[model samples]
Target: MDHLGSWRFLKVFLPAVFALHHFCHAETAPYYSFVQEATSAPLVSYYDYIIVGGGTAGCPLAATLSESANVLILERGGSPYLDPINKTDKENFFLPLLDPSPHSYAQAFVSEDGVYNHQARVLGGASVFNAGFYSHAETDFIKEAGLDGSLVNDSYLWVEKKVAFKSPVLQWQSAVRDGLLEAGVLPFNGFTYGHINGTKIGASIFDMDGHRHSAADLLEYADPMKIKIYLHATVPKIMLITEIGSRPRAEGVIFEDALGVRHTAFLTKDSESEIILSAGTIGSTQLLMLSGIGPAHQLEALGIQVVMNQPMVGQGMADNPLNGLFIPSPLPVEVSLVSLVGITQFGSYIEAGSGLNLAPSLVQWISKSLVTILNQTEAKVNSSSLLGARLKVGIIIEKVNGPISTGHLELQSTNPNDMPKVMFNYFQAPEDLRKCVQGMETLINVVNSKAFSKFRYPTISTQDLLNLVATLPLNLRPRHLNTATSLEQYCLDTVMTIWHYHGGCHVGKVVDQDFRVLGVDDLRVIDSSTFNFSPGTNPQATVMMLGRYMGIKIQQDRHS
Candidate 1:
């Protein structure tokens, strides 16, 4: 019992006990493995399709294209298995992947304002942590972007079939859907999809055991297969290998893995594949600019070699300015905030192997869209003939006039560790501010409905919050909350970006209608970054649909 004897005994016993406890905890925890990337010579190979950034779009595109020939998805983010962020379940996964310490990509694209941004370095890209809402582009919105209405129709069919897009049938409370319908907010329309036209269209989400699903779910084509998903992979530039021809072809791409190791791949004659850039609006456009396929003046100023003088890159970038109305309800909202309210139902879809929870109720409040068109005004101008043309079935409203975003992404330094300088000039246009004011008014109207009022367990009086915003000083504008009393206050406080940047590389900029970069022959930009207009809804479903549609189209083009 002496001091020395007791201390020696305690040390020995404590060490043994601590070791046992550690082992026990490790064994009890759910076990998953992380694939260590190759540190030696690159594990490079040739394939018919090399889709960079295996994310929201590239993942599905790779899976769909793989059915035809070998497809190599080149992602800068290393393997998804190694990423802890990727292991997240449907709920509470929004804990960002911005920290570079554990995640794959070095520097995330965060706005200086912090209010408007997204974390995009992981395997599933933004889809991994995004609120699962599947919406189609409004027909009119699509048409304004210069695509025919048929494209949207075809895309909707293809996406629903491939991804098994469904709703919450068994687990969800039916009142959630019923309440919205009874509110008169959801006007019935024959077509269901975007907020513009599909008034009766339902929202979509993955059936993650009554949880939620992601691109990871649909991208997994084979079980227990090492499909080579790279995370933290950053494609800095698209390598344009000039083949002896009239025009230079985009032969391959240059990318760096999470380890900061750079590598290049050449498009071979045998596997004369396509290089798809689904790296997102910011990522894809940055890559194109770095590759010298963007605005000639911008490229020249930056001292970048001009491969193609496409002034449209980063030109028509647009995103929806989201404004939410949080009203207290008398009842606890039974609906899961984790999954979107899928309400749309088609005949025989349930019997045709699609689940009953196959539609979402989110699309119920959208306007009816009849004709969707995309007339690229920048590179190819449309005269008075295209203007003032009205279509059948639905009316189109310009909630946000398609003002080209003034945002741009450029390298901070040669070091990949240094995050890119991202500037989103939100509310740069007076029309955008006007749109935000109008959108907020709409949100207030919808959330203030009697049906929505009853969803809260304890009724919340939003008048005080609204009054507070109205009275707050200009310097005291809220960073966390975006509530405002008057239109001026709302415009001043809630004037932030949706973190959904698109159309930077519209038809004239980096890529054309087929999503192909003009100067680069084989390279295509498939991510939302290539959108000509922000598809008047959540951009994920549209991005995924485009991936699937483009994958099939490219495969067919090759075969033909």
Candidate 2:
């Protein structure tokens, strides 16, 4: 055939083959139907509601809202469905954490006190990146939050059906459960979701087949035509219109796409049309402060025009503190995330997991954490020393249900791209330290129990343990060495965030009971930031429940 004739023939042939392939594989395609690239979004769009941050809370809230009204979700990151390396494969789970590319799913951040943390910059938010441990908040926490009992209860079911799953009990997890019961964390609750005061096997996002069902799965609830999800869309500011004496109102938002093209999205003429910030803890608080709904002094310092002098916008941030004991196992254990939890009498939650091959980035992180804990110079200890072995079991002791010693978030500058300054003032309160100490003691007791003996091979001697604990950076070490004091100091030095950061724009202070941002018209925060207090559990389940409840509440209010 001639060159021109051949070119025309190839065009016709390629598309036919492509279409045939797509048709054959249609059933295997990812389930997100309404998502679009940021560049594809219209330059000027209108919606009844605009949800910033297509994350754990934002995804569900947007899906629910779309059932009643048009909704727009502007996410700063790409879709997890598009990134199989980071989102789908269980063996390559840590790839996202190790990735430092501009488009990496996990955006790394550091706390002011030097602890490192990462936040998900994907459509499913942290739900795509977390360990997938699912647990409901304690009954006491529900009552404390003043949430409607029935609504909270029903909301869990709504989220659970979409994302939660029962993780199979493996060898390591079974041993941990037995050890917890042996340690007096009695009343084994088998394969339940309730966060009761006893050892329990809970639901997980990772299923038996090892595929994670993230909160993004909840997008199935959205009305496809009514929902517009734009990935890689960064909202810089919430546009507001104000009068001399009248309060400020959010009219729209200005966002930038991946190609650096700017666009605007506005609310409908309806007075009830609203803007919701579901940008997790840090992102939501940062966006609020950037949009002038933060401390007067802080905003003024950054030269950001103040919309409202809400001092509490970036204050009262809290993170669940975690300390763990690593047990080297001679036998290989199944690769798993959180499945079994021990709710101790001393106000701590104990969970166990196995089979994590630490990524290079995590190894570096462990080295830094060890340096801080041991008060040693960088040369003395390296990442290899901490994570040399494979086949290791981790006993994670978390001070989930304990005293809430909060922290604060501060803006580095007016730039939205610049990371915010986070200060999780862990162990600041006397009660918080006491709780951590008690939790550490409980972990020691559990490890020493005969139930754990079968798996625990004397990896480190008692003297070595004492020496390791004695080298902790905490100044207040007992003059005469003892296991109790050593463990307490180790906890003080080694405690890190479990990634359960909450309460920046909390209820009563930043937002109202209904989640409306205080003093701001037509705006609300419905993420972890809106949490009144940290629920004493893994927090993903509670956050999703809150998202569902808020979504339903908004729908009800609109109808009424």
Candidate 3:
């Protein structure tokens, strides 16, 4: 077998051995009670805390809360630990991105503008589905968000010990790193998680053996007897009671099991007992709207009684925009995900990843779809022809620290099963588009640098690509522009989301600094939805930090 084939075979074969080793020497493991078909069991009336969403934030938060208080976690999907295909097979890690099954670990969704994306439905949340790139937020982000600086610094360790690891920088990643420095993305900070303004090697969730440790692993901190997790418990709405002329208070949640049986879980009378919605940006916002806590007009139009007239519940959504340059190389690079990142002076982040040869049919479909979406052309050549003697390494340029061109989400219907209409007005701001162009320019420079010249094969240059894009017919341009006005037009056509969706239910608008929903008692949102702005990097580490930070806060409040 060739190098790539040998690597793929080893990845597939080694995991089964690891799985067996893990299963055989199991000691007296903690009794982490879980209800697969929650409907079959008698529903508990109340708990000290009901965390709706056993995901990145929810998993850690529930585990932490269970240390002192009775905690119940409702997950919309199954445990990743139980799935060998998703959890063990590293070669097929990205397969879930294409999975369309309702029970798939990654749930696929399409935006109003035809962009496809997926969100995690399993225990680790997106941490279980993403490419495992991990980085902390910039210090400015911490100050801007008004987070406790010291606590935030210390919080990372709590999560890092459980899942984070320094990625092994390989040949391709090293070349990319050197190229970034050569391109003037200076101050090469060595391996670290701090999000600084320069090139640096960040951590990842994937271990040395290519196995992923998710937020689910943090359940080791949980007092098993105090925590109960229910898989396939789809929460339809947060049950609330609004007294006449008084503020609404969250009572419990009404959910359904995989078997379609309904159940309700409420909070204890201890007033301190709260309902924390860590159901992610879309899920939490949709739940808020479905529970009649969104815009008054939207709720009344849907014939749902208004619980609160919070206009910001689903407003101000922001997703980091990304564009890329594919560089085909004659040599096979080590297979890896985001490791070396270039943080440019112009507020852009550049990163690269190596690829493996997938099945021909799958490759054909993907290539054809990408060609159609990106170039708006017919697939005249067979997919096999596209793959020449050399493989391609993707150089991704992201507008991380850019103008926040926020969008909004609207309810499609009163049905909880329906996905909210997401319109992430990416690059809506001229400054945002300008930043993206700068990012692409930096990436182009990096690829042209001497560090990459040895391995890089001759291909289209940046100027040639731009000029060709400029020559495209006006109507054929993105958003029906009359002309290719500038490189921004090309950006509009090529820019896509990097899956780092944030805002919507933002601080100072939908929720308070403590993450509690305004005008509502005994309720809180503790996910990316609470972020006032994107952290300008892969958000998993920050999300995990937020989980730890909030867990400590909640514990302190309960004790006080």
For model 1 the local lDDT of residue 149 reads: 56
Strongest candidate by lDDT: 2
Tell me the lDDT of model 3 at 28: 15
The true-structure Cα RMSD of candidate 1 reads: 13.9
Candidate 2, after superposition: displacement of residue 323 in Å? 0.7
Q: Which ten residues in a row have the lowest lDDT in candidate 3?
A: 468-477
Candidate 2 per-residue lDDT over residues 1-560, each given as its tens digit: 99999999999999998677656544323556679899998899899999999988898888889888999999999987655433454545666776789888889877886666888798889888787888888887888778899998898999988788887888778878887888788888887888777889889887677777777888888899999999999988999889788888999999999899999999999878999999999999999999988999999998999888998888888887777665545455677778888887777888767777566655454444444543432233333444543334354455646546888999998777778999888778877777777776677777777877766545443333334434443222233445425665566566666888888897899988888887879999888887756675688888888888889999999999
Ranking by lDDT: 2, 3, 1
TM-score of 3: 0.88
Candidate that beats the other on lDDT, 1 or 2, i.e. the better one? 2
* TM-scores for candidates 1 onward, in order: 0.70, 0.88, 0.88
Pitting candidate 1 against candidate 2, the one with the higher TM-score is 2
Residue pairs clashing in model 2 are none
Please write out the lDDT profile of model 3 over residues 79-170, one tens digit for every residue: 87665533433345556776667788888777765566677788879888777888999888889888898888787888898888888898
Best by TM-score: 2
lDDT of each: 0.52, 0.78, 0.76
Task: Give candidate 1's TM-score.
Answer: 0.70
Report the poorest 10 consecutive residues by lDDT, candidate 1. 346-355
